[model samples]
Target: MRPARGSPDTRSGVRWGMRLTLNIDASPLRRWHLLLIERLETISGLDLSISLPETDLPDQSGLGPLFRVEGLLHNLRSDGLFARASRAEVTVATDRPMDESDLVLDLGDGRASVPGRRWTLHVDGDAGEGALVAALLAGRMPLVELKEGGALIAAGRPGTEYGRILLATLDDVLSRVVTLIVSAVSGGRLRVPTLPPTEAEQAAAVPQAGIAQTVVKAGFSKAIELVYRSCFHAPHWRVGWRRLDGPDLFALKRHPDSGWTDLPDDGTRFYADPFPILHEGKLTLFVEDFVHATGKGIISAVEFGPDGPLGAPEPVFEQPGHLSYPFVFARDGEVWMIPESCSAGRVDLFRATAFPGGWVKEATLIEGVTASDATLVERDGLWWLFATVRDGGGSFSDALHLWSAPDFRGPWTAHPRNPVLIDIASARPAGQMVIRDGELLRPVQDCRQGYGKALGIARVTRLDGEGFAQEVETIIEAGGPLWPGRRLHSLNSAGGFEFIDGSAMVRRNPLARRKPAAVLASS
Candidate 1:
């Protein structure tokens, strides 16, 4: 053991060079390392210089050698350059003489071998994906490991650029192969990581009177951010009252083809929700018009016109009861909608008697349950509705429930496996799903840390089975005042533009030059 020395005075990497044999205390941890390596390699475009031990170490349970690796990341801000003799390379030489004089990484794809001692790396996802191990081997890759608190385990020297990124803590080599293997073998199913259980820490009270809202640089671009003003008693939402006060216009972010600047203020305030549909010849938006009052509800309508919201919102229809989450779906020329009839304890539908407005109730799909934010998608001749129901608290609580109807208008059935997906953070629907290169991508509000605070993306790998198989990635977080006070996340699509509701936009994009609805006309 060459005394660990990568301090300011003397910079030396933890010298463990020899045919090294490493073991993950738990199998899942091994799998996790392999996955991160592959992903980071793909995303950062750097070939990793780390690898797991060649042989498997059964999960005997206990925080293995990884614990030490974790501690190093938290404590060391800079890994300092290596020995002046070799500043560019972080070499790992084995004590035992090896038959092959090469650096070999076993990613199970095969072993990625290079006729060299060390390799340079950056976090990337373009290392090419097949199986994590196989891809690594195919690419002759090493891994960057993830330890406690998602810290990286780097065993070599660090350059200035690498050091700055290490601010997010990229210390270890990644193993992208093993984790993907587990995912494939399990049919792409996802669950809370099966790591060793952790103790619950007492949550610090939501900070004192005025905790200055600080900026948090995120590794991913966030979709939503929220700021809890502790000035009033119990906050506004909890008291069931949200005021529609603003500049009274929604300055659009990710505005559409209409060349619109903002939504109208003629008493129409857009809520952070989006509905996507193929109406006539192009994709269209049916955004939320939320009325903030004692008996407030969301309006179901689309923004029309060539430029943008042509005018104040045109009247769509009035549900006798509260209505929100009015999602529009068009199939074979006829338009249909699934509005939040949660208060009525069911998901009901209506056919549009006219385009842009005028919808008549057609059928009641699911009955005898509570559901809000109901979004509908038709795949393989099956109508699937993604929605949230009451599991505990009355507000947006519990996992999202999936129900299917043979026809958009009929008695629907819930997926045999109810709560098809859980995790408040990624399970709740932020808006509508986007079809990118044939992939069904849903923008999810990650409430795991808190409600509507962080944003995640769930790519549905499988929805044919009893339940869905998804791959989730936390993609964004609220930065700070540069936008608004946080809480900006939702996926919206209208015409040719895919609108991402960010914190700064006050009103929906409603211009008439290109779109059908006039922003301030016919109010």
Candidate 2:
């Protein structure tokens, strides 16, 4: 008993559906697509169940299902770029999917190839559903398989205009299928993704926007819950200089509009944490040089007068593991430096027995605590330290913690503001504090981009015997009209400010624009 030709069947459908039968041999990049599927459900408000083929992926290796879904999910959920879907459904065509809910698209020709997928995607019910299905089976037109979330509506109902939205929903699904099919390759692939980075985020990630600025946009894509994530293996640290770089010294000269100029050196990144004190007469700088390519970082000393890059980055402390965020200072005629030992579970103090490099471990300030970007301050005869600690499941670089002691040694007390600050945009310790007028001003890092990509200022609003409150004053972002390309914001000091600029590509020179990112190679 089929319905009359002109009679519309009204039905509001909501179901958890869809499946993925991946035909790939490796999982490093494949498993990621699984996560992409789950995200589609969240964004679309559909209870979607996305699955992969029944092959055994490595449990510990990159192939395993992990939290890859989580880290990306937040970015999507936190931002609302689309309206909720009222009614929509998806059916996938794949090989050996573990679940029964997944199957071939109802309109596609029963084959499993790219061309068939494309044709199925472009099909419209009015033109000829049969032709669409036949084209899908023949593999002439493509069947676009996508994991997506989108705005949709229940159609052909008795009295609802919002009843059924066919064209829009179909268009969105078609786009997703195209994007999903082509996301796996390199070169000339016109991808119609279910979701892509909103234009705003793309602007932020693009280079040379300016100094001290940032924007975060959530991407749209389906994702899966695999309880898997990538763990970064701490890399080794190396110290060296680019022979092609210009001199490091500056003449207090400022850029006409851009602000300042210093020769570019691609070695390690540092802020003005101060290592070798120039207080005795000569100028010395202590900084943590983080080597980007190797993922390792270290601490070193540099001496400079009017010229530049005093000497071949004098060796001070080198290690197989990380030794950075060095907060160097002079105490009672001894030079002490506190490098980021958060990895070693303690903050060790090294007293420089000799002038620039020679030093010995004099004490341990804190133990069993995770800290990084450690910077210290002394006022009213009390020593206070600042660093960012790892929050239960967030980036350690985003949370700031504080500890104080009568001296820089044991028995330190957690500041009443244990998490002296919680805003990731400006919490982690940056460069050393500089004396401003009469007040002490500290430079803080604003990691709006998952790393130190912006410089933030914190003014001491209250202090003395009563304690203190840090008031965030302002932020300087990368790629201002003057300074561009993810640059300007550094870790600590600038010269009078000094910070290892992360926004700028290594191959760039102040006089030169940072190289543009290579064009996308899609298939």
Models, CA RMSD each? 18.4, 19.5
- Taken over the whole model, the C-alpha lDDT of each candidate is 0.42, 0.42
Q: 521 in model 1: Cα distance from truth in Å? A: 25
Q: Which candidate is the best by TM-score?
A: 2
How well is each residue in 1-523 modelled by candidate 2, as lDDT tens digits? Answer: 5344323222211222223233322221222234334334342223233333245444222211112332354432311111212112223333343344333222222233322222122232222233322322221222222221121111110000110111222222232332223222111122211212222223443332111111111112222111211111112112112221332212111112323333233323322233435557765666666554465666667776554456545557776678766677777877778878677877788877776777788888877777886778887788778787652223465445678788876578775434433444456676677556667767666543435545566667655332345665555554444334443334333223333343332221232224322211110
Off by over 4 Å in 1: 1-190, 193-270, 276-278, 281-284, 293-295, 300-302, 392-395, 479-482, 502-523
- All candidates: TM-score: 0.47, 0.48
Give per-residue lDDT, candidate 2, residue 16. 25
Alpha-carbon lDDT of model 1: 0.42
